[model samples]
Target: MAQVSLRRLVKKYEGDVQAVKGIDLEIADHEFVVLVGPSGCGKSTTLRMIAGLEDITDGEIAIGGVVVNDIPPRDRDIAMVFQNYALYPHMTVFENMAFGLTLRRFPKDEIRRRVDNAARILDIGELLDRKPKALSGGQRQRVAMGRAIVRDPKVFLFDEPLSNLDAKLRVQMRTEIKKVHQTVKTTTVYVTHDQVEAMTLADRVVVMNNGIIEQVGPPQELYHNPTTKFVAGFIGSPAMNFIPARLENGAGALRLHLPEGIVLPVPPERTKRYAPHAGQEVLFGLRPEHLTEEKPTDKANIATFQVRPEVIEPMGMETLVHFWLQGTEVSARLDPAVPAEVGRPLTLAADMNRMHLIDPRTERVL
Candidate 1:
């Protein structure tokens, strides 16, 4: 096993068009880290640079503590699994897994031992003689993994390895990949645009935007405490609700005023942070889960919204509430058992501790 490190790593294309801004990351021995972002965000470029597929225009990349910026991909001691299986149609599973070893002139006994061991680990020993065209999508993926397993490289680089599978199969393969990582514990870096995949599979997730590193942290940390508005809006499923509110002081509590004749009580902690700038205009950022059907209370003096309900969606355990607040559409998650009506007036209270205040000018969490 090896530890991967990138210090001030940068990549630039022709005409000085920057692809990846300086990125500094440390992947400890036997750790699984994921690089995630939206399309055109340069996540794949970063992975390619690390794998020695693309040249590093600036900075250093080290695998097992050796700077290999000048090394070719075959000499980098890394294995990459692409979205496409890239398998030979005529080669059976055994031959496919043994191709790398065969090219290196490994002894016949050693190649057989390695391939068999990988097949057993992947539970594909029974399909050794099956061709790629005969295997299911998930099975072909397993064979690809088997190829990587026999190589026993220091680092495993996966580039959107599950994008082509069906939804159910994708989820199943996700669990299988995690199980494989647990047993082998090789340093792995996975890239994906799917936030759900990034959240579930990563020990640490790096969120990238516009070719620059926006934020990096544990999944829950990024979900609960986002530093930038983009991070807050991108990490959540229903996306965060952004409402323009006036910053004012009312008695001891800082008041959040809305155009719909609704005024919310900002808790002491929140007021303490925003009270100094009373007349400033700010954006109120709240998650859908933070708003509930219950009445607003004073134990934590959270903000409340009274609006006309537009639509309701019942999802097995919980329901989603849709309404208009201050001319902007917003949604809230509530118990599915609650009865809701269309075009009817309703009041929902938001959790104080779960609330976030963002500066409108800078678009940053306060």
Candidate 2:
């Protein structure tokens, strides 16, 4: 096991294009940390730097309390599973898994032991005789992971290892990867563009944008209380709905004035936070799940509004209701039993206590 620490890490390219811009991060021993962001966000660059595959422009990378900035990849004691699987087509699964150990000159028996153990752990024991060309995409990925496991390195790095698999296979492979981690408990740093994978696999998720750290926290923390508007919008599925609104004083309380003469009172707990922004345009963010057709049990914390449903999608257990709010399309996760139809006015409840007020100018959460 190892604790990976990155201190002001930077990666600069030709023409002065900076890929990673002095980001500091720490990964605890046996911890699984995921770096998640959109394309061109420098996530892959950062991961490569850690793996010694890319030269760093500045700063330090320490693994297991040792600075490895000057060390070659083979000497750094890290195993990486890549998106392309990187398997040798000619080699059988067992040979592929044992190749690293063989190069390191482990005894023949030990190599067999390690390869067999990894195969059992990855549930690929029966397929050891099959070549990479004969295996499915998911199986090939497992073989790639098995190859990494046999090395028994101090850290494991995954660069979108599941990206090539189909959707259903990706989910299954996710569970397999989690199981593998629970068994090995090696320090891990995974990079992916999919937020769902980050949320599901990471002990802590690092959200990056434009080569900078946007937020770093447990998945739920980023989802529930994002520090920035970008995180609030990125961390959720169906994404949070942002409506143009202005905060205003309503008698003794605070209220949000929306277009179409809609008004929603701010929860008393959040009044102090929004008081300074009164009468100013702010972005109101609410998740689809927070807007429902049924009234919440806590009526005091819920506000009702009417909108014409523009689209209705039945998702078996729940219905996704799409409506236009102030000309912005918004989605609501409502109960499947709710009577919903396109072009029909629907009364929806917004969870006032769960709303987010964002500063439009700075794009920061209030």
Best-fitting candidate, measured by TM-score? 2
Ten residues in a row with the worst lDDT in model 2? 293-302
* Candidate 1 stretches greater than 4 Å from native: 295-299
Give the whole-model CA lDDT for all candidates, comma-separated. Answer: 0.87, 0.94
Model 1 whole-model lDDT (C-alpha atoms) = 0.87
Residue by residue across 35-59, what tens digits does model 1's lDDT show? 9889888899999999998999999
Give the TM-score of each candidate: 0.94, 0.98
Candidate 1 backbone collisions, by pair: none
For 1-366, candidate 2 gives per-residue lDDT tens digits of 899999999999999999999999999999999999999999999999999999999999999999999999999999999999999888999999998888889999999999999999999999999999999999999999999999999999999999999999999999999999999999999999999999999999999999999999999999999999989989999899999998999787999988788999999988888888898999999999999985648467799999889999999989999988757889999999899999988999999888999999999999
